[model samples]
Target: MKPHIVMISPALANANNGNWQTASRWANFLRQRHAVTILPSNDPETWSSIDKPDLLVALHARRSAAAMEALRERYPDVPSIVVLTGTDLYRDIHVDTSAQLNLQHAGRLVVLQEAGLQELAPAWREKACVIHQSAPSLKPIGAACKSRMPRFEVCMIGHLRAEKDPATFMQAAALLTSPGIRLTHIGGALDAELAAMAEATAAAHSHYRWLGSLAHDDVLHHLRRCHLMVLTSRMEGGANVIIEALMCGVPVLASNISGNRGMLGEDYEGYFAVGDSAALAQAIARAAADSVFYKRLAEQCQARAFLFTPEREEAAVQQLVDNMLNSKSTNRNPFP
Candidate 1:
């Protein structure tokens, strides 16, 4: 019999948001072999029963703690894996009790990027595993396709949030003061102050624009058309946007952190200190104006992009689930 894997997440699989996208993509990958179900984290009735799932994959431990706790109580010996998020790794684990508890309950812990291993306590380090997010290779866009671009646009792809730090993009735009250059931001703003700031920035800056919450395809299309992609995150747990940007043949100017550095190799040259708009702006100018430098980024990004492909991610997930089931205690194995 196939093992039943329950994937508990905050949103549905198809959601345009990063967490949803991750859950959705993982489900698609894991479904090839195991029976997978996507359940809302807050679903109450399921918790009332002593249902034993073969494996429980819970994302953002803090966000889904209630369901996780319920599952742990019902299936004390089953493999329960906790996938950490940016906030959980870089922020919440330090202060959030629920997040810390979730870490304690898990038999196996998955970190999307390599740097996450350093964030764990010494005792928990042995159970941690690093899995790089995957993206499918894009059919090469012809050189002539480049001529269709009417402007040299610098694109920032993320919702307006404190962590994403969209204002840094605006500040960089203010510093650019170039006639042919423009900045386009895509994603919904959760914080009202950030939304107002984006509106105000666009109203005052002729070359700056805020494109609020676009559909997945639309955002990808825009990314494919842009000159380069910018990620100004204050902290990140392996952002999917960087992978998406690379697959689209877009150069990246990202914050210098474990997440970005892991995606773009340690030798990658395009990085600026987090929250430093001036330095980010300078990097952008260099990429746009210097052909040699721009080529270097594009070439390196393309080389690293294969690690994020659908084929690779799907294979890795299938293998992982198989290993978990095959390596279980002899008493739990039906044939044994």
Candidate 2:
């Protein structure tokens, strides 16, 4: 019989966030060789009915700490894997005790981007490996098709939360002078203040629209039709939106942060200073106005497309799991 794997994700399908997407996609990928199951949380009551999994994979160090600890106490020999997220690497691990404890309990650590590896301590770094997230590639919208549209549409996808920095995108909308440039925001308002801000911005700017909480397919459909995508997040482990945008051949204008740098590369030209609305506005206007610059951004994104292929990610995940299961050493660390 195939080994059973139980994955814990803080968010589920209804959340439509990166963590859920990662957990869902990974379960699909691993199901080819193992019996994979995903649980929203590792409640002891919930675990009581299920068999002890051969391996435990948890997303978000801090959020899943209790689950990891519970499993460790009950099944001392079972290896556990922790997939680090932006908050865990850039925030929680630095200040939160639970997040720190997760690092010690995990048998293996997974970072979504290469740059994420730098955030870990030397001992932890030795056991961690980067697994770039993947999205299925979509056919590129032809330039000829885009030229027929009356306006230059740009999109930002993420829940309206403080961490996503929706204010920067809204401020950019207010700063934009181009009559033909349109900005559309897709996401549910997780923060009431930000939701009100989005409503006010939409009412104030004729060129901006906030379409809250679109279906994943609808978001991608809209993304493929746009001239560009913008990501203004304060932090990201590796953004699923960036991968989706890249896969759809929609170039991105992202904040200049380590997570963004890890996704788009250090030399990518389409980055603005984090939280700088004016700079984001200028970048957006320039992309809309300068055809050559716009084309360059698309080309740069296309060059990096191979990194996010499903085949590569699936193989890496399989190898990681296989290595852990086959290891003979009592030490839980699998990667050399």
lDDT agreement with native, every candidate: 0.81, 0.91
Instruction: List all candidate RMSDs to the true structure.
Output: 2.7, 1.3
lDDT tens readout by residue for model 1, 1-336: 667888888777445677788888888887767778878888868656535668888888788888888887777777777888678888888899988899887766778888888889975677777777766666545546764667777899998889999989988988885557779999798899999999998998988899999898798888877888999998898998999888878889999988788779788988899989999888888877788998899889888887888877777667666666665544343111
Candidate 2 lDDT tens digits, 208-292: 9999998899998999999999999999999999999999999999999999999999999999999999999999999999999
Q: What TM-score would every model get versus the actual structure?
A: 0.93, 0.97
lDDT of 1 at 93: 80
TM-score of 2: 0.97
lDDT winner among the candidates?
Answer: 2
